[model samples]
Target: MSENGGGTARRRRRGSATVAARTGVAPNSGDILWEIFLRLPPQPSSLPRVSLVCKRWRRLAADPEFLIRFRAHHRKAPLLGLFKEYGGWVSFTPVLGAPDRIPRRRFSMRIDYGGGAETHPFHGTLLGCRHGRVLAVDPRRREVLVCDPITGDQRRVALPPEFGTCGGAHGAVLCADGDEGHVHGGCHSSPFKVVLVQISFGPGHPPPFARVYSSETGVWSDPILAAEGSRGYVDLSRPSTLIGNSLYWWLHGSYLCNMEILEFDVGRQSLAVINSLPVGDTVKSKGCIQIIQPEDGRVGFAMLSYPSLEMWDLKDDCGGGVAAWVPRKTMNLDLVPNMRVTEASIVGYAEDDDAILIKFNNNIFIVQLESMQSRKLYDCFVRHQYHPFASFYSSGSAKRKA
Candidate 1:
């Protein structure tokens, strides 16, 4: 059993004197005990479990100060796992144990919904992933759930009233709770918010609707229009990409298949369309477009054409706030001889390490940044739905530590 992000907190509320009395130490010695716990292994699988040693330990471990320090110490761990949900089966196969590799357990959501739950591993569509938590819609499509697969904690999203069907609700984003202003820890006790991207009906030119639910308020906000400046529905199937505090939607044109990128400010509850990828003269290039956060912690666009994949970073020109998209990495499939042997497609962007997940025939591979090599993880059959995601534990973790 790993450390509980917050659930393991001992409610005993022992006094400092009582704690010191139990340990046969002076009251002022509690600081020394806390200092010792500060040295606990940074592994998420250890600290919480170790806290159960005693009430005093639990108190020390759950201390916001300790959590902050603990997070700072183990902040450099890379993507520890890749979760895949396909063919009505959703499983998180541990990937962090690779000898020279990427990272988890074979954990699946065992949901218990209102004493009327679905299957052990809920057949659901994974909409978005962040902070080690996933937002998924059940197979029935009746509701959206914010789930922490590791901790088995889930909160059903509050939907907009008379919102009708889930037709236009293509994407869901989970805003986790942590500290006072930000999301930290493992999302065990932090109050969260769920935002649903549900499109509005009618022909006249209606913007996509954003149905938001806040855990603290215990209610869903009325449907609000999203991606205001752009028109036409987004490719509902494609998961929305989050960069900084804004979520982006890759909107496609109706007839000619035009592509547009729109940014939605989560805090402001507003949307603005941004520049699209520079396909240059090859606008009709047969490939897929995905928004990725590259190694430099900036939003990037990755376009896959045949055996070649090119990534472009969204950068600002020298002038004040002049937005520009710049090419960053280009990997030719020729390096991987087998890539030419069959059909391949870009799966999505791995935001944690700036790699691209690609599907070649029956297997899934991550295009590596170093050496222009590739790492293969599993064999994803045609019927399975694959969603590769990792928490914000990269170089960003160090700076984001609360």
Candidate 2:
């Protein structure tokens, strides 16, 4: 009887060990790796933290398959942060992705003129990011730097004659149109072809003529005259916006409330006047064109109407010309006396994505476009302290820390 009981006890212990091994409680190397890959999605933002949990997780996170999956998931996530300030600039990143969630991973970097007692005049901010590399210009020193935010690797390029200016300059990352002929073969359109455009304003000039830069050829081209007979009267407050290869700027004419849209053909290196928005008496008097991209992916330009916010949509024009001003929606401050839209500007359009971020009264507000629910992201100064800009990049690399 004693021998039988001992044998039974040994059998029960063996069964318990078998169950633990099968369920991964005492996981093997393969089980640990598979588990890490399975936990990658939904919590991609937490990858950086996961890697630090254990040695097995760190190795699994660095796996090629894990990185590919992480990149695919991160591309669709929303990220909002300040990039630069003191140069009157701000940017937004509509889509951000990372493959390796290692320490010191940066999606973007900002270049600004460091303010000091000497107060050196600096050009506007410039961002160069594509194919895992970025370039930025320092206006105070008149230099361009090539940097890898992930590796902390950087190379500085001296500015050519055209890039140097005391007043300031603007820079852009331009991508060439891959579907020039609409070739839709097995060839997936390569989104990597890109160029850079920088415009420098001469010192003490009201309106600055823009200097062009091309990353394809890596040289500074000739100066682009803002418009015929209106060289020094254009509005340099807002940075140029790129739709495809073309760059758009809002040029306010010298005449009272006159405005024209300047479209720069980045590929052809030419410029043309596209269309003009109708400036109402109230908007004309305010001396500003407030363009906002809503969460619905619609681009609306608004101007102060005192009590009412007047907005117009440019998407429905059908290229016939600038569409006639139409009122889509209005926010009335009179109804909510305590709530005010301050430092109000449309950062970008998420388009049916439920959430939209807007800057009001120097504060950043993330509001649901459908539900109208809202939350304050941070303090005004903390939100806009860095010059904010927006860009979208492909996802396929390892996850990296932001």
Candidate 3:
């Protein structure tokens, strides 16, 4: 019986070799090849080049289930570049090098900032990006454009009439799918929601409100007022930080006013105001403040005071009804080579990457929060809004149907 079993195993091995030579693929190698391809870097060009290897490889690479597995294997999307709006034109600055660096022209969009006589003079604002889509407001057209930087697909959704004359506006784009297990890096085809928060500074205008637009419904919902008509100034210059189902924006304050946080709950479709950070007098002078989500995925606050960065986390109370900010670790960035931290401000935050884009002394630098490593991206003296664009993009993946 042992001799018979040994002969049978040898015959099976020989059979596999014969099949491999005939079809150019080893028996059961497809499963192994699938696993190997799943480990490829989540870059836009990764799968396309893999598809070029051969027809079988191309078939496997284009498999929708394989694409989903590839995205799930690498949970977080690669930070391909940063988007900034300047002179009514939104441009993309690639953060990666060579093969991973997406060209600027591929994602660039020219805002029709009411150049024609019939259109209003209101300029478009590049609000923020999430799940591979960019949200921008074109008030002149009374509509918001949802742009897919990967495929260059743009969907124009008209805003509610009340938001037509808003003093200032800041918006957030997110995938509408509420599945917790759903991977977001490649959500090009997923339904999404656009939350537009209106800012009013003058009298007689309607109080600040938020209106949500759902792609599933193809229309905007009724305006949701902030809790008890909470009158707080939203810092439109800074992008919002999304923690859990809530989106947070830093509220700027005047000399007599204290800064606060604006919270928008996507699930409840409600807006509320959170109290100001208990930064205390340690920060005698306010530098650049940004709302950041820390490594634990909790709501966090970061205040950059020239050389040092102070981090804070929101801790829930015993009953969980109220939350308070707790001081976290502070890192000194003065060790950044060759540049004096004379003028420093955080331009953008890459939530998944755990990094922030800092504008220091007319040079843009990307500083990793955990590693504390820094690298200067470029130099720019002009003022612009930067939104970090991170997504799992593939040129061929978009063209192929799932």
Candidate 4:
């Protein structure tokens, strides 16, 4: 007690010294508080920019906990309306209550490509979306883009040089793991794998060929050549849709006039010809292949037969000797003006949610399956909008489960 107080005092000093020696410094109240803040879930709105603040903050912002919280809050968030004016796309978060209510804020950004005042020569449509990316192609430009709306990240890929001289119009099919299939369905459990199929017209004197691209491998590989014997007169103007790993197109060949479904095996990097829809009398009257996701976690390809919607289960292959075409459900919308089922393209499906989005004559409509009711969402056409496409981002957490 004379030199250094009591034995207890000496032990306390030694304990503090050991902690300082191990950690390189005495723990301060401020340091402990900062650590606690780092472990807490971040605010959703500021997450993207917050990740760029500092290394420590970036890690915290990217934490799975933060994403979960962000997505949970985003689910109830109001829908965002985006439109093009003066040659650029602008986004506005709509007011929840009234359609006439003014938006609280506006986001202005320019898309690099647009049709402008001229009508787009390409007639292809958007097929699928994954990892916040949208895939679109224009036959006129003979170009393809994998784009991210939120980050404005785009990768432009040109068609093969031979595709230019092929004379036949061009079409593209974008495929990715489904939101539910990736999030809930235990399919292939790899997060980095993505399969995209680009079907381009082969040079004159031969059949059309498909180029398959795997995100796992940056290079595109040639798959087995498709039989052009039946696709000589096929129109390339209309885009193809990807259901699962397969791309379907309406082939109007001289030999057989029908919709051709080309299945590209993502794992094998091979191609196989699936069954084709029966040919109808007229070109315009023929049924076009459209992919729709039913709420029950199944992908359905609906072939529009005038007044009726002919649906098929994409997951099941009608046995080799069996008839594949089985009538599932039909909706008669002949009474709706300009709403003929054949003219509208199925843009999105939330089957479990009992809703589907269709694009017809450049207008977007939301329809309820049970009630068979339709409502126009918005008029996306502005200044001859070329190949207008829309895709939503599933939280990265969702892809991780895939």
If scored against the real structure, what TM-score would every candidate get?
A: 0.70, 0.56, 0.82, 0.52
In angstroms, the error of model 4 at 158 is 4.5
Rank by lDDT, descending?
Answer: 3, 1, 2, 4
Query: Compared with the true structure, what per-residue lDDT tens digits does model 3 show for residues 53-131?
Result: 8999999888666676677778898888888877766778897877777777666664333454242222477788888
lDDT of each: 0.59, 0.44, 0.74, 0.43
User: Model 4's lDDT to the true fold?
Assistant: 0.43
Global fold similarity of model 1 (TM-score): 0.70
81: Cα error in model 4, Å: 6.7
lDDT of 1 at 268: 81
Deviation (Å) of 50 in candidate 4: 16
Model 1: which residue pairs collide?
3-48, 3-49, 86-385, 94-104, 95-103, 95-104, 96-103
Error of 1 at 72 (Å): 2.2
- Top-scoring candidate (lDDT): 3
Counted clashes in each candidate structure: 7, 28, 0, 4
Write candidate 4's Cα lDDT for 231-267 as tens digits.
3334433334444454445444444444565555554
Error of 2 at 45 (Å): 4.2
Q: Lowest summed lDDT over 10 consecutive residues: which window, candidate 4?
A: 181-190
- The runs of at least 3 residues in candidate 4 whose Cα sits more than 4 Å from the true structure, single-residue gaps closed, are 1-64, 68-131, 137-143, 165-205, 227-229, 232-238, 253-257, 275-289, 293-300, 303-308, 314-323, 334-363, 368-373, 379-402
